[model samples]
Target: MLAAAAQDADREFSFNEQEFRYIADLVKTKTGIVLADHKKNMVYSRLARRLRALRLESFEAYCSFLESGDSEDEMGMFINAITTNLTRFFREPHHFDHLAEKMSEQFGNAPTASRIRIWSAGCSSGEEPYSVAMTMAESLTRLSAYNFRILATDLDTSMVANATAGRYRLRDAEGLSKARLAKWTIQDRSRNEMTIKQGLRDLITFKQLNLLHDWPMKGKFDAIFCRNVMIYFDGPTKDRLLNRFHSCLAPGGWLYIGHSETILEQRDQLIPMGKTIYRKALR
Candidate 1:
């Protein structure tokens, strides 16, 4: 027992198994994110800042504050702290390549087709949807003929705000080609930032959204980019989300997921089009 006591004494906060389990359960219940045993350190480190900010002494106190009915604002802070947002411009190039190639075939054949909708479900910051905008702008000959829009949403409100602002550091946009950079963004040398051009910004709507909750969109999407978001969820959550995506997609619409993600059970509903790309089976 002395060894265990010494180990506990080394910690900045008094974190025990019970408190960890409680936090894990709450996260899973509210956000569908499963915190495994290996994540204990990560959780402790991330939440320690909250303890300092709230002036809470221990993990037990933090857990109690969360359980209390008055933690609505704190809960939002907690979720923001827990959710990871690591993304860059065109992180996965192949997805955009496929989108560029398929745009003509999908919409070009139907000259009367006037609406093209794309949803970036876990759009971190703004890169993914901006990439989509670039592809759409370049692909279509008669751009003004169709009503094309991209919906970008994220669970973290801060991320949503950042995306809505449509501003980023120059280094963050280095991956983009010279042509895309020149055409789609305005350089602000004073601030060392680049603001997305009004044309690209006009095509996108960024909003805060929790994927576990009900989605407010009524219209079907022609393409959905929910990349890297499902890594946090368990098997059941992933399965449910895949089914939901299938339902949300327009007939023969496309779904682009993270490179690491796979569709094991939803094969019948979504067919593989290319690497990490799936198409909603036409009814």
Candidate 2:
């Protein structure tokens, strides 16, 4: 009994049930992320860092400040803190395999005839986008004759800056093969760091984007990788975003979602190609 009382005192900030719900609602409204009752502790733990950084007293103060400002800058920091970024190079290798197949079918016959555009939505820290670039560069033998553009976007500004740097710790290079590393990456063994060779960065454009907002991109994408991002959203939010994606995709373009994200609705619009990969039915 005494230990339990003492443990309660160790909590850095007071997170009441009301505060938790308020935050959950705000996050859902702003970012389309659903925070459940079970996630109360997780929410407190993540947001506690923000409270500490601002030297604020509680979740109430943080939420109050958020409400007081229509400030996009502070809001960015809040979203950055809340959004989970768990990514590494070549994650879910099967997606890359499918991508290679799609590329072969597209470029094999009319290699130089058409331009290829790929969107790496929710591209965390550049890994997924870089992996996409590497895969395309490797697959095409007659690359010089064609044009390819990869637009990598994230809700987190810090993540966009990091992706733009194209510099990653060497330890995270595990997914890369020897030939890929030597060709596309410049490594510093002594510092335990690696930066992407300029050639790889040349193919990618890193942008900061809030998926819920109006997109500034002009052209429809041939393939869109929004992996692992929509899992946090509720059914309605997912539906809306998928519809938006359908509109953004070119005729017969592909939409690749996270392995964990299950799509139950919109079968008529997004034809399942198996493994959570879908093709926008050419309408």
Candidate 3:
């Protein structure tokens, strides 16, 4: 049974407190993710798979290798494996509703004024950005009237590549409405997979980016969706990213964070408008 398997899995790896702490420090140093004591089991479970894949026998050995210079190449795989990517189409629907409202306001006033730029930060597996694309595609009747671009970035390269592919299992469509699916996706029953067609996929650019590092983008965005991404970071990291996001926004731009996450500093820059939504003020 699953219980017995879990018991065996617990015994398979030797993760001491010191080893775990070392890993916590390394992950914190490299990725800005604060892994605490409560996450010990989760860490063991996730990294255990990595150990098996790498043909390593124990956590002690794995940790030793990780700290050594030999792990430079595998550091990427380590982060990718440990990083959580749980997401769904139209997740936290209110953000999408607010997004539609903003788009409506933009087109109603001046549809051809400027390029509408939206950034989906920490866009795991492309669902969030694709959802944005689909929402804009459906809402904007005069789609070609103005320039539009969405920049979707995540620290995980695998995630960015998958998002760029715009392909998913057909069963994944369960969360979306029938009409929405019909409009934005091309279903292949034989392959049991669905892919985002060219029209929808063309609106966005998927890139690998680390929020903690310098961003190559030199332009401002109208709206930035950084939902559920900052929960893992420490206060100073979150504060710095928020400040960067504030600087990256155009006047009257919007910033959205995860419902569970909150801004620890800099309340003066963003005025919260709705659930987990804040509008940027001109500075």
Per TM-score, the best of the predicted structures is 1
Ranking by lDDT: 1, 2, 3
Q: Where is model 2 more than 4 Å wrong at Cα?
A: 1-8, 70-72, 111-113
lDDT of 3 at 112: 71
Q: What is the lDDT of candidate 1?
A: 0.90
Q: Report every candidate's CA lDDT.
A: 0.90, 0.88, 0.87
Candidate 2 lDDT tens digits, 167-200? 9999889899998888999999999999999988
**Winning model by lDDT:** 1
Tens-place lDDT digits, model 1, residues 140-209: 8776678888999998898998998999999898679988888889998899999999878998999988
RMSD of each: 1.9, 2.1, 3.0
Q: What is the TM-score of each candidate against the true structure?
A: 0.94, 0.93, 0.93
How do the residues 5-106 of candidate 3 rate in per-residue lDDT, one tens digit apiece? Answer: 666456787777788898889888878999989888788888989899999988999998998989987888888877789888999989998888888877
**Candidate 3 residue spans exceeding 4 A from truth:** 1-10, 109-113
